[model samples]
Target: METTLRKSDEHESISDGNELRHGSVVIAAITSCTNTSNPSVMIGAALLARNALEKGLKVKSFVKTSFAPGSRVVIDYLKDAGLMDYLEELGFHLVGYGCTTCIGNSGPLKNEFINDIQDKDLVVASVLSGNRNFEGRINPHTRVNYLASPPLVVAFALAGTVSINMEKEPLGTDLEGNLVFLRDVWPNSKEITKLIDKFVSTKLYTKEYSEIFKGWDLWNELKPPKEDVYQWEENSTYIREPPFFKDFPMEKPPTTDIKGARVIALLGGSVTTDHISPAGTIPLDMPAGRYLISKGIDIDNFNSFGSRRGNDEVMMRGTFGNIRIKNLLTNREGGWTSYHPTKEIMPIYDAAIKYIDSNTPLIVIAGNDYGMGSSRDWAAKGTQLLGIKAVIAESFERIHRSNLVGMGVLPLQFKEGESATSLGLTGEETFDIYGIREIEPLSELDVTARGINEEELKFKVIARLDTPIDIEYYQNGGILHTVLRNMIKK
Candidate 1:
């Protein structure tokens, strides 16, 4: 069988033989617990790698291949089976121990590939054994991602491109010019089961678990303060005391009607928590990246947003910072919004800062199923820090709606059969929600939209405070505030 190639018309070939013109598999990672915990799949991946190596199949030089097992026991079993060498030969070298590529820690591609992908605007892909393949949750450059078993991850890395059918098309040619197919190297169920039964044991588990509580040399070297109240470092970029409890009063604050609220983002349907609070790589030009740079951190050392999440400064700036997010306020994609005061298009964080500085209350308008992806608490925390007083959408994802309430950010739903488009919300109108002070669980409230020309558009929205506890949380200005007040009383 001859290797199939999807020819490119507009863009020139980046590969040596014009092989990867369709879409390159830039990242192939076997990370996270989804498949690694299962010995069958783990050994199966190793067996496939050994078979591919015997046939002289090589992963493309461009593919960034890594193997991050969920447990050290996975390593012990593979080493015991003597299949680790084959995996390493095929570029599946061990990178880390846990949650690497799946959580968007795939890291940077080669500088050469990065330049080409950006310059040509080529679509790339990542095939990971880990479960998560959310948009912008993988590599920023890899637009397309596929969740596959560990063996398939290696196969795609060898194939070098996703634009092929593994069923029919050959992955690559062998050293003897013989065509190689997926079926040829795929490990049988019996072989996977036999390996699992042979090498996986309680002894391996016991050894790994015995040393789990023992700290590494680096961890042991840390000298933590003995003070009950943490001594916050003034210049630490990794961790900082969050401002959530700053100036917190013992008495619960009165809930006020939201007036003169500007829309931070007018998003479409299925707007995920990943879009709201990305855990991926920090772009050099983004606000979070700029903040890191200003703190004297080099671009290479500016770790992922997830790594720096303990620092509220970085996390807050990272809110709505997904590289793929489309804020309808601007006529472009990415984490950008129209700063209504100056009619200037800017990064969402910058606009948020300006809004916060001017004491302008912020609200996000979205379509149905808003905040639907991961139940990231930072999605709500970042919103609160950005001074977002409310989020009005056609509907909300259940957990995210609860998170918003827990953060004291009002979650309001548009009336049934009504949407932002139907209501003619240009995302340019000043919004006001009346009857918040006298709110009840699941209460209907009046929303007034004042246009630039002072035209009033009136509608009703449902306050999504679902219970008495939720109402109490809101009235006290968030769950944390409620807890602090109760502690003070006690």
Candidate 2:
């Protein structure tokens, strides 16, 4: 089973850490197209919420509950059915007209709850009908997640613990001390059918979505920069022209060997793009957050990593910055890397800056299934900006491997059954990649590393440029650079 799932009916919510603990549902959201698009499900959820609230079913006050519909038609249907108030009364109010939980847009939980979890290390959870449930994708604080239907989300919030069986457990006690189970509150099929038939109007969807292309009035009024070429600004915080095409040439670049490259991070298997370049809420202490703060931006307005993808400075700072990332280089958790031979502990961005200033090239060594999720472009762009000349991994995902090549970073794969662990890499060694002076697509490269103990190790990796076009993209320092150079010549 995937690590993300927990059978609310069977598993014990408490860990063996020697304490009795209830599984806390910190987030309970009926907020995804998965359910909201269906008239039957949305009305059913509201009806269930209505029943629970009337019976005095109470959820933990700390649970960050929400309801986001896919379109305005959902709100219109609920309102026409007079069931919108029923949901809001129980705190499942409409929050947005888009996807939420699955995308890590469940928003922020209460400060009190966040502080409590951090202080106590509570094994928290979220019950959402969202499609994706990668480890940290659902708020880094919530560890266990259960994918349920819209009404089940409400049921779990009332039950307040994933450890309980909805069929067998009492959600809460009523005024007369009556037990309230999920079955007692579940809406009957006839009621849902009647509400769907009565309230769903074709105009609701057509009217709400018609102007989507023209966009909002504010966006329509927004102006664009006048110049064909972007005006590079040194002080702009949100975005600035990248330096990849600076002094670029129309002709192809030389294939070059990389020597004395330092390992920026040593990672383990299933290292998703989220781990490489996260797009969630940025912590105030991370390098990207500090940079935003230094620009006098308030913490609340700092936005998210996804909102700042156009900004190379911020994205570069956010590379390998996921709070859950486990980098083996410094032996500490979360984006910390030792600055080369100096052994100074600092943020990955800071270490990269120091290395760039001193002309020390960087690379990463990883276990299997590297660059697996989100297919984010920044994962490659940021890696290049961090001075990573190449990435040597036991395996690679298709898109990210291509993105790395498109960003002028070489992608290398270890022979089967060979990896950093198999070769005993400590991540503190100086690496050398040879045979690049006349490199070809799908070629083999020799690798050597010198550790702190002055021991040298040698290995071989297959160049991952699968085609002549990929090699061209890499040699010209990425696809964008190649495009720009051609444009300038014309």
Candidate 3:
């Protein structure tokens, strides 16, 4: 199934391998859960944009600047600050309500700008205040995207390029093409404080969120069960109660003498949660597509994975990626799964299913700084649902490591100087850990990797089971499960 970005034919949609683009980035959106969650940051962005416009700063003709705030109160405060018009004048339009550019819901790039980007081979970048700048999430045309503060996003939009650091460097040329430095219009903390005090009010939270708690039209329509505990719905793929909902096993899991288990996927360095559970547009051919079709929703009607987070079927199927993962094992680009014995190519989700049925425990191997970005619990939840027993990386992001522990997935760190590649791991390798339940931070886990053929490798991975709280969370399956169980007991 070929996945084409509905926007334009400017950049080719990557089916497998790295397909980067050279385009003057047309969409410069400042959106993300991080900054939008903070009222002051969003207000800061709005004020900067307003001040920029007053100083006769204009966004590049090819650029489209938009602000998609995470919370509704952000917009209310922006309005209260009277900076909405200034933002709009600068082409910063309000597109949708939730997680827009951050999750790659950048909508469509204008046809003219898309054409110019392709023709010129522009190396366009999206400067967002949110975390997670994984290659293809923003827009297909955007070749390189950088994460920044909300104020920096505004500065980038005014300057319209990623060539220089706006803090010290000049944005672009003046009328004579002379350099225009960022300091020319940079707002001081004192100025930002005045705006914050004038516009952003604590009252807005009570005003804006009061209605949000009233529930949306969708929530009102959902039929609730009469019982406190939800009866498991077998066929419904949306929200099935997980297997961990049952009582914990009386006995601990076998720590050693585990039989052969093949590698599920061979990952690379800096593989963030976005690579693990990308919340982008769902393709028509994925397992998620089939599930949605069964529910009578056509491919076009299919929105995003983030919107369907409660649905285990959609999320678990769309876990790794939609059509944009660069899998190294099969040497096939873009989200294909490689079978162990056969060393064959299949869809990633389907491959996981095969391993699950065979009772093969799954593990993800990656380089340094794995699972960085966002406090999104789904990043951990989906992987756990996908049956990934463990993740071995050189380093771990703070939130995601905690999240992995919460979901009962063992997180291991590679010893310094040792990497997944250094260990010569392919997707066909089988692994085992001895004395896992008794594992402590930096405790070595004996690991043995044997390929489908005669090749075998061995190494020791460090357990990143940081604290007693983390161990408790893992024991309880996940934070949600732990909280629910405690509530029930009370």
Q: Which number leads on lDDT?
A: 1
Q: How big is the positional error of residue 312 in model 1, measured in Å on the Cα after superposition?
A: 0.6
Question: How many pairs collide in each candidate, listed in order?
Answer: 1, 0, 8
> Which runs of model 2 end up more than 4 angstroms from their true locations?
1-22, 33-35, 214-235, 486-490
Q: Rank order by TM-score, top first?
A: 1, 2, 3
For residues 90-154, could you state the per-residue lDDT of candidate 3 as single tens digits? Answer: 88778756678877787666787678667866566777776667766777667777778877777
Off by over 4 Å in 1: 1-18
User: The CA-based lDDT of model 3 is what?
Assistant: 0.71
What lDDT tens digits, residue by residue, belong to model 1 across residues 194-267?
88888999999999999998979999899989999888998999999999989877788777999999999999
Cα shift from native, residue 285, model 1 (Å): 1.1
Clashing pairs in 3: 16-333, 16-334, 22-121, 22-122, 23-122, 24-122, 25-124, 238-311
Number of the predicted model whose TM-score against the real structure is largest: 1
Q: Ten consecutive residues with minimal summed lDDT in candidate 3? A: 14-23
Q: After superposition, how far is residue 215 of candidate 3 from its true place, in Å?
A: 6.2
